[model samples]
Structures are given as C-alpha cells and as structure tokens.
Target: MGRTLVQKLWDAHTVADLGDDATLLYMDRVFLHERTGSVSLKGLESAGRKVRNPEQVFCTMDHIVDTLPGRGDDTIMPSGKDFITTTRAAANAAGITLFDIGDDRQGIVHVVSAEQGITLPGLTQVCPDSHTCTLGALGALAWGIGSTEGEHALATKTLAVNKPKSMRISFDGELGFGVTAKDMILHLIGAYTAAGGVGHAIEFAGSAIRSLPQENRFTVCNMAVEFAAFTGLIPPDDTTIEYVHGRPYAPTGKTWDAAVDYWRTLQADDDATYDKDISIDCADIVPTVTWGNSPGHTVQIDGAVPDPSNAPDANTQTSWARALEYMDLKPGMPIEGVPIDAAFIGSCTNSRIADLREVVKVVKGRRVAEGVKAIVVPGSSQVKLAAEAEGIDKALVEAGFEWRESGCSMCFYAGGESFGDQERVISSTNRNFENRQGPRTRTHLASPTSVAASALAGKIADVRKLG
Candidate 1:
C-alpha cells in the first residue's frame, strides 16, 4: 500500500517514535502571538531554558492589539497593552524575530507566516492559535498547540504528538458563480456536522480544491479546526510553488531550484490510501450562511431556518433551540432577508488581499445601506498596502465602509472593540458562536462578497442575487 501525503510528511519529520502512536516530531517553524506567547515565553524563562533555534521562531503583536488607525501599545481591550509590551520584551529577550506594532510585518500570525514565506511545503509548523492550521495551504503539516506545548517546541524544536488518523476529502466539480471557498467549507460542515472530521488529519484533494487559488486554499484550510479535524492540508502544486518563489524568507538561487524539485513531489502517490475518504460535489454547493450560532447550523442563502424539532438527535435539537432563541430567529423564516446591523470583512480566515478584492468588486459604486455599520480590515499591512495601490481601499471607503488597520478585529469579543449588544452582524470571519463578536451580538458567518452584499442591503443578502 502506498502512503498518503500526511504519512509522507509525518515520516519525514519524525524525530523519534515515542510509542503508543506518539511521535516526537520536529517542528520546522514555531509561530507566536501576544495573546498566548507571553505565557509560553515567561514559562521558558522561569524554567531557565532557551529557544533551541530562535531563527526558526517568530512572534508578532496581533491578538489583543488594536486595529484602529494610529494605534500603539494601548488597546481597547483591557490590559491589552501589557500583553503587547510583555510579549515584545520577552520576544526580544529570547532573540526571536518580533513583528512589533507599527512594523510593516505586523499582522495575524497565520497571515504573516504565509506572506513572509516562513511556511513551506512538507514543513511542520505550530502556533498557539487555532487558525494556525491556515498554513497547511502550503502543503505543510501545521496545527495549533497550547502555551505549555509552545514552550516545549521552543525549547527543544520538537514536540510529542499523537498521530492522527488520515482522512482525504475530495471536492469534485467546479464551484458555481457567487460561491467561494468560504461557502465550500461552510457547506461541508453543515452537511457533515462540525464533528465530521474529529480525530483525523484531513487532506483536501480533487478538482475543486485544485482549482482554487492559493489564498482560497488558505481560506478553506483555515476552518479545518472548526470542522473538528486535528489539522488539514492541501498538497502543494505549481500554484503554491509560484506563490512562494520570490517571498522574502523562501529559498534563494540554487536553493530555490532544489526546493521546487522537492515540492513537486509532495503529493500523495497514485495508490495512496487514507483511513477515511469523502467526496463532495461542488456543483451542489451554494452561497451558504450560518443561521444559528454554531458554524454547523448553516443553510443556503435562500433557504429557511431549520426547525429544531427536526434535528437529528435530542442533543442537537436542544442546542438548535437555544441557538434560535439566542439569535431571536423564528423556525422556517427565510434567512435571505434577515436584517443585520453590521458587516465585518477581515480575519485570518478571509482577510487576505484576494478576499479584499472580492469585497471591492461587490461594494464599488454602491453605498452601504442606511443604519448599517460596515468595515474592511486587511489581514496584513502588506495586504493593506497592496489594496491601496490598486485603489481597493478607496473603493471600499467610498462605499461607506470604514477602512481600518490590519489585525484580528471584531473576530471575537475579548473585552475590547466589538459590535453593540444584540447587534446582528454578517461577518466574513470564521466562528459565530453566541457572544463571539460581543455580548449578545449575533454573528452570521459568510464569504467576503456575501458580507459586502449584506452591507449594501442591510440584510443577509445573497451574493448571487447581486447580478
């Protein structure tokens, strides 16, 4: 039997077999953010240990940092400055590269990692954020870890990890108009349940995945954790190699040639077999949105809110009932015309330049609807700069959206900036659990274009209807 891509990457990084399905795997890159990084760095200091390879580790101010213009150490989140200052001091003391506030490189860890070429094919990476799985778009084996595990990887450059069963999800057919990578993922979770991929390392494959741009691949893999997968990855291909070729931290000259040769071979063998396999018909996917708090509680843009009484199980029925009550939604109500108070178009999940461009396409020449507060935040400063060069930012601003600095803004309620209480929001960010955006703020997750359309309509408008 041939080995899957996950098997190949796992075998390549095995430092030692620790028995009982656990392996001491070498981590090629370890990323950190102010939110959880301070704890790991402080713990390492208390233990009197040093980073095994500081050059391979990187830190940034993102989690609690304010994304408002002219922002500095001070943040809207209570004590947010302490997290920033302490992380800066600790990162400096440890000798790892720090993308401090105001630095052009400052951004979300996952976004910066990809943009800087810090993650590449076949490498193993980890961060203290769940979205670290976003890096797997480059065909890397990456996942999230706790602060304690972060310290271990920093000190030894290796971590003891239990091997997860391999699963392959093949997306067949082409995506229809107005549907996006975000919708594809949302549709998957909705169809299979969020726990569908539990305990498995999922490898996304097939025609639809291959057809996605590199950034779209990131959007798809970013939510693998939300799918309850241990991690997710896409096999690197020519598009990936092209994206990494000239990146600052990527290989150079002869090294680049050698790296490309290896990356081309990163795909699974023709006969490779996985522990589980699932095939999805992309033709059936549409512009999807979450009607309930859980991402799994999703429906097509034109579909009606499902009745909790029809839920598959008693537990599911109870949860759905609570979600409906919290959201103030009625069973069988059409989701298409539901009113929204805000629209957010940024997060590690969908804040890349490609995503912003999509937003611009929908919002240009159109003003936001009255009573709707809309904002567009790029994933990185680089992304922001690029969008400005192309006039994407100006277009958005002209359309009545606030053009803001880059960071994980309004993606979660961290006692900082957030939507008003009980506000209904259509957001491009991943995750829409109750109170995710603010106390009593009900979030509806959708794609960038969907968000822009909703912002203009002041409701959960379908992007497909824009035509």
Candidate 2:
C-alpha cells in the first residue's frame, strides 16, 4: 500500500523511535506568543540553557496585547503588561526573532507565521496554543505543546511525541451558497460530537476541500482541536504553492523552485491507507450555528434547538439539558431570531482578511441593530492595513461595528474586555465553551458572514435570510 501523508512527514522528520510509540521528531519551527512564551523562556533562563537553534524559534506579542489602536504594553488583564515585557526580554536574550508591537509583521502567531512563510509544507511546527494546528493546512506536522514541552523543544530542537493514529475525512460534492468552511467544520463537529477525532491526526481531503482558497483551508484546520484530534493537516497542492510563493520569508530563486517541486510531492498516494475514514457530502451543508455551550451543540441556521429527551443516551441527555439551561434556550425553539446582545468578528480561527471582507459584504448597506454592540478585529497588523486600504474598515465602522486593531480581541475575555455575564453573543470564534468570552457569558459561534447578519438583526439571523 502507498504510504499516507502523515507517515511521509513522520519518516522524514524522525530522528529515532524511542519505543512504546514515542519518536524523537526534529522540529522545523517553534512559535510563541506573549501569554505562554514568557513561561517557556523564563524556564530556560532559570536553567541557564541556550536554545539549540535560535533561528528556528520565533515569538510575537499577540495573545496579551490590547487590540485597541495606539495601544502599547498596557492591558486590562492584571499583569498582562508584565508578560509582554518578560517575553520581549527573554526572546531578545535568546536571539529569537520577535515581532514586537508596531512591527508591521506582528499579528497572531499562526497568522503571522503563515503570512511570512514561516510555515511551509512537509515541516514540523509547534506552539503553546491548541489552535497551532491552523498551520497544518500547509501539510506541516503542526500541533500544540505545553509550556514545559516548549522549553524542551527550545533547548533540544526535538520533542518526544507518540505518533497519533491517522484518519481521513473526505468532503465530497459542491458546497451550497452561504455555506462556508466554517459552517462545514461546525457541521462535522455537531454530527460526530466533540470527541469524534480523539487520538487521531485528521487529514481533510476530497473535492470540496480542494475547492477552497488556501486561506479558507486554514479555517477548516483551525477547529481540529475542537474535534479532539491530535492535529489536522491538508496536503499541499498547486493552490498552496501559489499562496506561499514570493511570501516575505519564503524561499527564493532556485530554493523556491526546489521547494515547490518538493511540496508538489507531499500529497498522499491514491491507494494510501488510514486507520479510519469518513465522508461528508458538502451539498447538504448549510450556514451552521452553535446553539449551546459546546461547538458540538450546533444546528443549521434554520433548525431548532435540540431536545434532550431525544438524545442518544442519559449522559448526552443530561449534557444537552445543562447546555440549554446555561444558554437560556428551550428545546424545540427555532434557532433563528434568538436575541443576542453582541457580535464579535475576529479570532485566529476567523480573523483573516478574507473573513473581514466577507463580513463587510454583509454589513455594507445595513446598520447594526439598535441594542447590539458589534466589533470587528483583524487577525494581524498586515490584515488590518489591507482591509483599510480596501475600505472594509470604513464599511464596518459605519455599520456600528467597532473597527479595532489586530490581536485576538473578544475571541475570549482574557483581554479585560468582555461582553459581561448573562450577555448573549454571536461570535466568529473557534470555541463557545462556558465563559469562553466572559464569566457566565453565553456564546454562539458562526462564520463572519453569519455574525454580521445576526448583528444586523440583533438576533440569530441566517445569512441566507438576509438576501
């Protein structure tokens, strides 16, 4: 049988097998942000250890930096400024590249890395954030690691990890209008529940995946963690190569030619085998929305809230009941027109330039609902500039969406800004767990376009209904 893409990446990066499923894999790149980067860097300092290869390490001021324009080190979270300063000092001492505030290249770690070509096909990347799998869309073996593990990778350039079982999820057929990668992912999670991909490295493949723009592929891969997967990847293709070519940090000249040639070979063979396989027909998917505390508690925009009595088992029934109570939603209630207090349209999951552009298309001629507080944050400084240059920012601002600077604003409430307890928010973020946005805050996750429509209606309005 032909080897799987995961096997190829593993074989190429494996230094040795340590028995019991553990392998010492060479790490091609290590990324960090302000929140957890400081902890790892401080650990190295205390141990008087030097990075095994500083060139492979990079740090950015994303997680804790305020996204407000003209913002500095000051932040609303207590000691947030200290984290930034400490990371800056340690990153400088370690000789690692630091994308500090005001750096045109600065943004979310995942966004900046992809934009700068720091993440490429057939490489290994890791960060201390669960969504690090976002980079795996380029066919890299990327995943999250704990801070202590990050320290070890910094000092050794290798990590001991057990190889995860491989699975392939093929999205077939063509997606319908208003259906996006975000909706497709949400549908997958809802169908299989949150633990569906546990212990597996999911490879998203098939006609539908190939149809997406390279950036939209990032959206699909970004939510892999929510499915409980070890990581997620999409083999590189012509689309990916085109996206990487000529990037700021991408290989140049002869190196570029060679890289493309190699990346082209990164796809799985036709007869490759996997431990598990699944197929979802894209034509059946619609604009999806989460209805409760978990990403798995999702329903189609036109569907009704799930009734716990119809759940498969007692445990699920109890879980569904709790989610409904927490969300202040009733079983069998129509998901559309559910009132909301706020809307957020930015996060590593859905804060790219394309996401912002899609939202603008929905908000251009409409005003936000009178009682709604809506905000739009770009994923990176570069994305922010690009949107402004295209008049996207002006459109959102005029529609009453607070056009803010980059950084993961409102994706979660850790930044000292939150929608407050008991507030209902329709957000274009990855997670909707309890208090994900703020203490006791109820969140409904959806695509940027859906968020825009909901904000305009001041309720859980479907984008398809807007037209």
Candidate 3:
C-alpha cells in the first residue's frame, strides 16, 4: 500500500502501537533547552530518577542567550545564571551531552543538532521546545512536549503520543527569486489561518520542498507551531544526505552509504493516504512579511494591510480588526514604507550559514540605516565559525550590522536588553507573537535577506531592491 510521508516516517519509528490511538514511539534523540530543561530535571530529581538513555539526550542554552557584546554568557540572565547553571549540572550529572554556554557546540538545540548531524532521516526525536519540529527537515519525526512529559521521556525513553491526523501540503511551481521558505510558510499560515491545522501533522512535500536548501527546509518546519500543527516535515533527499555527510555525528565511511540506502527506503509509498491535503502554486507566493501579531496575519510588502471589506468572513473581519488594533496598524496602507527602528538577522529558524551568505550578498558595500540598530547572531558557535570562514560575518559587520556571539538574542527579550518600547523591528525570527521580541514592541517577521535590506533602508523594503 502507498503511504504518506508522515505515515512512512511514523510507522518506521513506532516502537509499539499501544491501543487507544496513541503509540509508544521510539525516540532515538531528545533535546532540552535551558528554559524547559531546568524544570524537567527538577521533576526527575523529585521522582528520584535517572535518565534512561543518556546517550540520546542533548542539552543546549539558547532561549535566553543575550545577543549583545559582554552579555553573551548570560551573566545577568533574568532568571539569574542559576537556572541555566542547574540545567548544565543536571545534564552533566546524568551523562547527557551538554552544550553549555560558550561551548563551541552550543546554540539553539535544533541548529546544533543539525549542524552536528544528530538529526537524521527516519529518526524519532522530541524536545521540550516547540520548534523541535525543525528537525523534521531531516525527515525525522520530531515534536515538542511539556516539562513533565520531557521528564517522563528522560526517565523512561518513551512517549505516549497519539497518532495525529495527517495533512499534505503539496507544491509544484518554481519559487521566484528572493522568495524563501520563510515566505512560503508565512503564506501557508495565512492561507490556512493559524488554527487550520489543529491536531494534524503537516507533511510538506512535492517538488518545491525537494528543491529548497536544507536550511530553508528547516525554516519551513520551524514555524509549524504557528499553524497549530503538531509538526511539519519534508522527506529526505540527496540534499539532506549530502548536508548530513561529514558532520560530527554523521555516519562515516561504509556506514554512510548504508545509512543513505536505508534512508531512501523510508520514503512514502506511491499510494500513501492522508486525512486531508492541499496543493499550493509556488509561483503564486511572493516575498512575505507579517503585518500583525500572528504569523497568519501576513501580506506581501507590496500589498496593503487587509481592509475590513476584503475580509473573507465575519470571523476574518474580527481577526483583522483585532490584529490591526493590537499592532497599531492602519488597514489598506502599503507596508513597504513602514519605518523600522531596528532589524535582526538571526534566529534558530534562519541563522544558518546559508542565511548569512544570502544577506551578505545584499549587505556588502552597503551600510545599515544610520539610526536603525541591527545585529547578526549566529544560531550556534559552529554557525559562527562557518560564517566567519565564509567571511559573511565580516561583510555583515562592514555593512553596519553588529556581529555578535551565538545566542537567541533579541529573538527573546525577556532579558534586560531589548529594542525600544513600541519600536518597530524587522526580524528574521520565527514568531511575531505579541511581546515576543519585547514588551510593547512591534515586530515584522521576514527572511534574513529581507531583514538585511530593511536594516539598510531603515524601512520595510523588499530584498529584491537591494540586489
């Protein structure tokens, strides 16, 4: 029987199909970040338990790593260094691999895992962070869980997960230049609305997905939560295999060939079934930016904010009004000339070397807007090393963008530092959730290139013009 990509991957890693619509899934890898790991470890301690599979566990500090100079080590992390320190100590005591602050391997858990080749096709993985779905780009079955659930997995090496209904988002047309996975996913969120995929596992398939670079695919899956999907995935392909090759945790020599062969076998069968499906014309999507708090409230820069009259339904009109009021935006106004106070070009979703290089192409020989603050934060120390080797960092710094140490930075502003209150920022991070970047601040999310262009123009300008 033909199978859908989700089913294929799901079945491949099912340790046991426990009765009751849920499965005792086998998790080959587990990730923990500072914010959630601390509580999970505390739970394990309360239960007088030890990690069941220390080898499969990995911990990284990213969620609050300050992206500014002299603050990269989180000396003043709002939770006090104690929270992050406890997680590091717990992981170390449990024999779990820890990417502690300042560790070369340290960065966003998802970025470090992929950079180190820990996320492989056909693998079942989970993390305490929702963006764990980013690993799905490597064809892994990955998703997020709560602190208590993470502790349960850490203690037992298994998760009781319901098999989610599947939705296939197929695409066929070629994406236009400067149109990236960030744009595609933003468009998807807009088309489906934030709650459209509730309770479903989304499989992003078809030619468009296969053609995207591995980093871009990561960007696509990283924001699955915005659509309320349990997870988002892309099947492994040659690019996936090649990108994994030679990394620290990747298969080597004879084993490498065998891994690829087995990975290929895990592809969906020709007749695979899905609970629901939608096909998108890739050519129809344009470079996109978020106009409101939710990712679903996005429009092309050239497009105007939604006028209440264009509302598709009563519910749509209400949503539009709410978003407009919350964001302090005027409906029917063109977005291109919206002034920005700051620009950010890094996040777990778009801070890979590929993203940096793409922005470098536009930023070289150009300078950021004089009064607009901007920074380039790599997702991990390894990403920083890779970008520096490519001289992307130098280009970015030369273009008036500060080059900072690897950390989540302004992507999370719970720490003391943040953009101005009520200031507008063009960012490359995943969520535009209210107060996500800072209290009372406005955020417009876009691709790395778009952010760079905006930083230079001091407004929400398109990257195409920078080129």
Candidate of highest lDDT:
1
The model with the greater TM-score, 1 or 3, is 1
Q: Report the C-alpha displacement of residue 254, candidate 2, in angstroms.
A: 0.4
The alpha-carbon lDDT assigned to residue 464 of candidate 1 equals 88
User: Model 3, 211-329: lDDT tens per residue?
Assistant: 99888999999998888999988889899988898999888989988999998886777787889899999998988999988888899978998886689899888878887887788
lDDT of 2 by residue, 286-349 (tens): 9999998878999999999999999999988999999999999999999999999999998888
Task: Estimate TM-scores for all models.
Answer: 0.99, 0.99, 0.97
lDDT of 3: 0.86
lDDT of each: 0.93, 0.92, 0.86
Which consecutive 10 residues in model 2 have the weakest lDDT in total?
Answer: 409-418
For model 1, state the Cα shift of residue 160 in Å.
0.3
Model 1: how far residue 26 lies from native, Å = 0.5
Candidate 1 regions off by >4 Å? none
